[model samples]
Target chain A: MFTLYEFASSGNCYKLRLAMAQLDIPFQRIEKDITRGETRSAEFLAINPNGRIPVLVTPDNRVLPESSAALWYLARDSKLMPEDPFQQAQVLQWMFFEQYNHEPNIATSRYWIHVLGEQEKYAEALAEKQQKGHDALAVMETHLSDRDFFVGRDYSIADIALYAYTHVAGQGGFSLDAYPAIRGWLERVERQPGYVAMEA
Target chain B: MFTLYEFASSGNCYKLRLAMAQLDIPFQRIEKDITRGETRSAEFLAINPNGRIPVLVTPDNRVLPESSAALWYLARDSKLMPEDPFQQAQVLQWMFFEQYNHEPNIATSRYWIHVLGEQEKYAEALAEKQQKGHDALAVMETHLSDRDFFVGRDYSIADIALYAYTHVAGQGGFSLDAYPAIRGWLERVERQPGYVAMEA
Candidate 1:
């Protein structure tokens, strides 16, 4: 069995859980509390020197960190990935957008405002993050305007990566009112086979 | 031939230029002036809705944006990628670390100080970035202290993704004096066959 080390409430970690469910991959999860700095513990650092969670330890004992990397590995030969090489790169394109442009802004804001109850403490910073998170949503909305998914005409890990945080963006103070296309895409993603919610 | 849209001074853009040179892939360069806001223009936005440079336009006219994705595309079947599945995911782990942790701090500080000459204007922000950037450098130092390359004992796109900004981290005011391992690894990346300077 695979062993997934994660923070249950973190969408980055949730990406692995959702992907595992959809792919029918069996894994045992070990929760790490980020609030208490468990991820930064010396023992945790040994597993990932950079000290982040959502790491996957395969049945063979190989360690893989980073939610995107873990998702890619799980989806590699499954129906979750694209067959075309160019489409595969497009998948990476959206995933990179999620990491670089989406998650940092959306997830960070949520962590501060919702998870840490620091809405007022980080008011100034939250305002800035809120604007950028909307920009990221706008990009996603425009992309999903003409297509059902982010990449070719199918559901892929790209959707899973972006959906992890986007579904709960209100926790970051982002409203989906302006992004009908993105909302529609989110529904389509939820309806995919064996799709699991983060709370699970 | 590939048509590479770039802001030449950006290491993110340089990742593509350097990768193309190493792969012996011929490409025409279309320089975009980011300072003048060219990337955000409607035409460029049509090319990449995210409005970022280092976008690759294939000979067949397929447009692929995001430097990491383009590098993965160009290196997919080449010696630049690892044949092992787990090792390939390790490449993504480091690349995500570059985008999320390293670039935002290191490259942003470089842009504020080295490129924009706004050192004093953004002094406070730069200081925080400097600390975080060093943290990123320290992680690279420890990782490289024992390994020759990022994954599977061979130089891969993970190196190119990281080497783009890391080798020039000094411009970001991050002194590598304490990171001899990182310096040595930089030299190793420089010696790879078909490697070309960023300016070319």
Candidate 2:
């Protein structure tokens, strides 16, 4: 069994829970409210000095943080991880793209506009984020136009990683109407077995 | 042999070169000058739609982008990667931290202040980047205070990934004087066999 410390609404945390569900791994969830300053508390800091949520405490009592890392751990030997060395690297490439290119823009915009409701205060940043978020979506749209999945023609954690914030991107003020391929790909992800939607 | 498309001065590109040296892997290098807009060319975009340097083309003609993912690929079967699953996840955790936390602040600051010399132009963002970069260093200091490396009691790709930008963080106006543990850890990394320095 694993113990996951997370924020229920966070896409980063949702990535882990959704991966575990797909992999059929049993884990306990401990919710931390970031908006209430819970993640910054001393107790949570002890679990992850970085003070981020979606940390996994393994059956052996080892603490693992970083949502994508947890996904890789849970799906390592499963069909979710590609076996070919190059394909494995490709999976990681998209995962990194999600963090570096996609999440910072899409997720941050969603946080400011939807969760925090501080869109006015964050107007300047949000404007820049929206442009970059669309750039990220365009890249995904181009890639998905020729493929069924991100790697190896199968639904892998790369899909899950990118899907987390992307599905809720509308709340961030991004329109999916311009991205036909990404829209089709999102539906393909939803149809995966044992899939769990991000909780409200 | 592998073919690497990179910018010689970028810490992100240096990461792959350094890792290959440490692992004794030989690869051909193709330099792309980002300042000259070489990465944005149609040819480069055909190789990686992301239009980023540090892309690796495998012998089998597979194109892989993203520095840390390429590091994982080259080091997966080597001593640079942990054999244990939990330790592997730990390695991935720090790699993710390097990408999501450390690199964005440290590397971007370096580019603005050192490479582009745009400190005044990016004054507002630079100020925030400096604070976040220091916070990232503090986390590394606290962690290194108790350990020699990021994971499994050995130097792994996690160290390589973080070390790429961190050793040069001073160029970004980040002082290393307060981070004695991180300074010592940097020296420890330099002492590893087959080590290579980031090019000027």
Give fnat for candidate 2: 0.84
Encode model 1's per-residue lDDT on A59-83: one tens digit a residue. 9999998999899999998899999
**Chain A TM-score vs. truth, each candidate:** 0.98, 0.98
Best by DockQ: 1
Show model 2 residue runs off by greater than 4 Å: none
Docking class of 2: high
Predictions' DockQ, in order:
0.91, 0.89
**What TM-score does prediction 2 earn?**
0.99
Q: Write the per-residue lDDT of candidate 1 for residues B1-200, one digit (tens) a residue.
A: 99999988999999988888889999999999888999999998999999888899999999999999999999998889999888899999899899999999999998888888899999989987877888888899999999898888999999999998888888889888999998999999999998887752
Tens-digit lDDT string for candidate 2 (B1-200): 99999998899999899889988888999999998999999999999998898998888778899998999999998999989988998999999999999999999988988888888998889898987888889889999998999997899999999999999999888999999999999999999999999886
Which TM-score values does chain B get in all models?
0.97, 0.98
What local lDDT does model 2 show for residue A112?
91
- Quote each prediction's TM-score: 0.99, 0.99
